[model samples]
Target: MNRDIAIMVDLQKLWDRKVEFEDGISHHEKSIAFWEKKISDIRKDVSVLKENLTQAELEIRLKEKKVYELEEKLGKLQKRRDVIKTEKELAALENEIKAVETEKDEIETVVIEEMESAAGIKKSIEKKENELAEAEPKMHEDIAYLRSKIENYAKEVRELISQFNAGLSKLSPEIKSRFEKTIKSKEGKAIAPLEGETCGVCHTSIPVHIVLEASSGIKAMNCTNCGRFIYKKENV
Candidate 1:
């Protein structure tokens, strides 16, 4: 019932609520982190697909160039027929042309296959990008909501801290120091009401004199067993 103990009890209740809000903030932060990881994974997949498309495009270009060179070689070989001086020479030139044509056909086939593959890769990339574009906004919206919740919790904690400081400043230096020590030792709880003759924290019996001093409403006292500041409540 002492003024100093009353102030500390109020601060302790506010601190208790702050702890709960801090827990809420942590929960929201974890959810945001989860969404952020998903976004990162999606972008990573897109990047890998793009790299694959690049490689496929490069290979297709090389195959097409090879086909072109083979065509040129076949055309030159055909022109050699005009200058052939023997049937043997004609046969040799025909064989050379056939070989060049065969090689060109094989390369062209590969080029077509690679072009299809590249097209498929491009389609995959587009689909993933589209998915990201659509889903990213929703993800961001969810994150924003989570952040807003955290902001609200943080704001409450800040206000509680401000009010708690104001209340704490009203106490004498000795009481303030004792409250800080007990709050730290007990993790933000510095006072407990007497439960009959029992210590509310440790459930130990209160000594006759300590209980008398605390219940007098003149001074606050500590539990002999658990070292927590003890108080007696007046009827509301």
Candidate 2:
């Protein structure tokens, strides 16, 4: 085969391999992104937990203050019991004090329930924080590892591209330009090996004259149907 045609074959193979290597790089990039998103979500969840804890604490403080106020009110009502001058007045004072006591008891119950809720929330926060402390570092390590793999794949692609460009450099400018254009138009495939008297890719019958020239390796020709360069390899 002509040296230029041989180089084209080699360049074609290089281009295909380059695509595969780039795909590897792409895979790693996607994995890195996934890890990053997962970490972000975890942090967001932790932040939301913190906000809820703050709100719960504030609520508990408010309820406790209400209970204190009710107790003070009950104490003053009890002191009024000592000053009662009649049986009817004494009975009315006792009923009023009982109402105050009931209200205070209900408020205290809510305060205890809220304190329990706050405790549970605190425990959840602690658990999640511990998980984050451990998982965040591991996630970062995984992302770093994936990034390194991408770097390696990128380096390999760069080298393969250099080799492919070297093969193109060996061709005449016209042939090189033609190959570049065709490869782009054909999605990275610009040449096909001849299949007997037909185009290997499109299977279009080659004119006898064109086939003879191609088989002789005297010149290069394109298949009219598929528009790819046709080359014949020697029988090995």
Candidate 3:
């Protein structure tokens, strides 16, 4: 291939490498983001579990306090029962005692249920804590590795860009200008190969003479339809 076309091809290769590095960086960044979100979600779950446990404990305490009050009332009523002289008074005392005992039983049942719920909550909290403990380190390691990969990709991108610029500088000003314009217009691809009589990029048919010229590698040409610089694959 002509020197200018060869330079353009090399420049395109450099551009591809730079894009590859940038893509790698992007992929790693996305992975880091995903892990960050997962960590945040886990932490939120742990917080909610802790809140639930606290609420359950509070309810248990309140129910136990009610039970204590009922028991105290029942004790006082039983002590007073012996002093009652009338059958009616004794019957009233017994009914009062019975009522107090019943209330106490109900409250005790509630407290027991609440205690059971609290125990379950504690177990769940422990499980979640363990999960967080295990996941946190792995998440950190993953993020660190991804960041390191992105840093390396950044360096590779810089090197590729430097190489592309150096290769571009070696071309004639006219060729450089044309290459730049063509790259911009052709979505970063300034050059393509001819296959048979077809432009590789635009798939347009090339005239016999232009195909012959491009195949000869004596000169660099553009696809008549797409205007991308064209060369023969064998020549490139």
Positional deviation of residue 79's Cα in model 3 after best superposition, in angstroms: 2.2
Winner on lDDT between 2 and 3 is: 3
Off by over 4 Å in 2: 86-95, 182-186, 193-226, 230-236
Highest lDDT model number: 1
Candidate 2 weakest ten by summed lDDT? 180-189
RMSD of each candidate?
4.4, 3.5, 3.0
Candidate 2: what lDDT?
0.85
Q: How do the residues 88-185 of candidate 1 rate in per-residue lDDT, one tens digit apiece?
A: 99998898888888888888888889889989988998998998999899998999999999999999999988987888889878888888777767
| lDDT (Cα, tens digit) per residue for candidate 3, span 1-236 | 78998888888888877877888999999999999998888888889989998888888888888888888887888999879899999998898888888888888888888888889888988888888899899999889999999999999988988888899899888778988776656267788888889998889998889989988888888888888889887633
lDDT by residue for model 2 (1-236), tens:
78778888888889889888988988888888888887788788879888988998898888888888988988898999889899999999999989988988898888888888888878888887888888888988898888888888899999998998788889877688989888767367888788888988788898988888888876778887888888897773
Better of 1 and 3 by lDDT: 1
| Best prediction by TM-score | 3
CA-lDDT, candidates in order: 0.86, 0.85, 0.85
Full ranking by TM-score:
3, 2, 1
State which candidate, 1 or 2, has the greater lDDT. 1
Q: List the residue pairs that clash in candidate 1.
A: none
Report the poorest 10 consecutive residues by lDDT, candidate 1. 180-189
